[model samples]
Target: MTIPTLEDSGQGTGTAGEARRLAVRGDLTMAHVGAIAGPLRAIPPAGHDLAIDLSGIDRIDTAGAWLIHRMVQDWGAAGVPARVENASPDADRLIAEVAANDRPVPCHVPRGNSALDQLVRIGNAVFVITENIGKILAFLGQTLIVLAQTLVGRRPLRWHAVIHQCEAIGVNALAIVGLLLFLVGIVVAQQGAVQLRQFGAEVFVVNLIGRGTFRELGLLLTAIMVAGRSASAFAAQIGSMKLNQEVDALETIGMSPIEVLVIPRVIAMAIMLLLLGFYGSVMAVIGGGLFCWVSLGIPPVSFIQRLQEATPLSDLVIGLVKAPVFGFIVALMGCYQGMQVTGNAESVGQRTTQAVVESIFIVIVLDAFFAVFFSALGYN
Candidate 1:
């Protein structure tokens, strides 16, 4: 029985009959093995002259050659003589010698799609995002309800947890923040003094630092540190719980993991960020004042006077206002990434890193948004 001719319409220098040429191109890895198989096995049985051009082939492995061999077999089975051409020296020798008896293998067939497939793909994506958004909103609402309940529930604040978190978030962080803020204040004050001195307005350095620190620096610095410190901690803790399936166990036991695990930590972070902002403002002013007095020869009383005159109460309030929002975003990102963690210890570490990076990024973005918003509202 004569096997039907397999049509070949791939790119070559000439038309189909003008010296038939078969080209194999693209990755030689398993990814394209099946794609190559199709054209190769479809060679016409009436082939007068055929050349398996490996010209476009860049890299090749055993799998690639096996694919090519299958095509050659089909040509031979069709009683059409075919010779491999343009083969790399290595590939040519290998194909002619080793894989000469290479038999045709069945190509992998991809799962077919039906009408339901289109619906499923679209519906699943829409459903997942909707569900996730709902979860996030519910999480926020439930957290707020829990916070309100705690305030009125007549249960004394969990001073122990609060104190523990304070020590970890505030006390343990004090030295690093103090040192950094001190240096930052000095740098900012000195820089401002230099420009002000040019205009004989050096005393304004005090006002600059005072207003800038309380209105922005204190909050920004505190949020950044917490994003790095506390957000990372949340991710690590929750990721560890996830790794151990503790979150699952909590869910199974009828506990709202968001309530039990997430809310308290978020609340603690918010409180700690507020305190840190206050502390940083004080420290930045002190350091900035010292820099102005000693380095710029401005008197302490004069510096304080200028600062009080230049900085407004609104600046202080604005800075404090941002703390809870920032804390909320940081904590939420940490918990979200932690919940997404899978795999192993490596995944935990990776998720922790991602959580901190994402938290910091989100913080900066929100800070910018607030800056522009407040500017428009005439609050800054």
Candidate 2:
């Protein structure tokens, strides 16, 4: 790399060289960029072989390396064989890295096909549904296994937790459940009176209210409300435990989260939903009776007689039988989603919402199935 060069004094000229080649020198860095930039640009670029010596460079950095690179590119464009000599190994590596990374990245462009896009969305939705169903079944099996372990081993069901949960889910829920059912009952009786009066059948309002309240609306609405309230609560509590690593800590210590957390809620909901369903049905009946007595001039005693005569014991049995089943589905969905929650606050909130949605959906689907089954059995 022997090339004569002037000692740099921030002058943009290279050292005097044999006329056959141009040379570069000085600290080719950002700080000295202005001194070198003008002189380098002013040099003629011919489509011929060219050489430059960097041995005179006192120091170099990324900016200086880039500047040298840019000059070489310009010479290359003009068909000159640009050679950089005597650069430090570090400077050489930096320059090579920058050049390699300087190429433009390839981008993917989506095609415009509305039909294909819709098909893709439909396929994805089906896949997600199937995957969710599989997860729920797997979790249900795991819960049952844990329940058997509790029954067979020294670990027993946590009654204290179940009692507390029952109070929370049942006792605390009663007021709202009663109030809403009372309103529904009033609406039913009012509507039935209006429609039946036109047909000279106004006295049948008690029968209308009683049969619907006990057989379907009572337990169905109770389950929906529980799905909205307790399902989210279950998911949120377990999700928070998961987020805080408490669930993992329990697992690490060889304790079952399902036994400790899930079973109690499951038992509580199972017991409470039955009680709540019956209670909700009674409240609805009372509310409907009140409306019938007030508006239709029917005496309370007469309304009770009509209800007993028209609605059989089958309706009450149906509602009670569905309660535990609905509770089971709600608990399964809530606990499965909670267990799915990862160590993130966002996931906790997301799983809680998903739990509520899934619980409500499953309850409705089960109710539909029960309706069809009872119809097939000629029980309703």
Runs in model 2 deviating more than 4 A are 1-110, 151-154
Best-fitting candidate, measured by lDDT? 2
Best TM-score goes to which candidate? Answer: 2
lDDT of 2 by residue, 1-380 (tens): 22223332232233344223455666666677667777777777753355666766777777777777887888888875577777778778888987877776759775779999999999999999999889889889988888777778757888899999999999999999999999999999999999999999998888899899999999999999999999999999998888888998999999888988998888889899999999999999999999988899989999989999999998889889999999988987888888899967999899999999889988998999999998899887
Those runs of model 1 whose alpha carbons end farther than 4 Å from true positions after fitting are 1-142, 145-159
TM-scores for every predicted model: 0.64, 0.72
Candidate 1, residue 208: lDDT: 88
Reference-based lDDT, each prediction: 0.78, 0.84
What tens-digit string does per-residue lDDT give for candidate 1 at 1-380?
A: 11112234543444455556666666665555665566555545564656677777776667777767766766777776667777789888766664766556679966677887999999999998698668657656866776676778733355566567667777888887787778888888988988898999887788889888998888898889888988888889999999999999999998767666776677778878888888888888989999988887778898888888899988898888998899888888788778878979999899899889878988899989988988999986
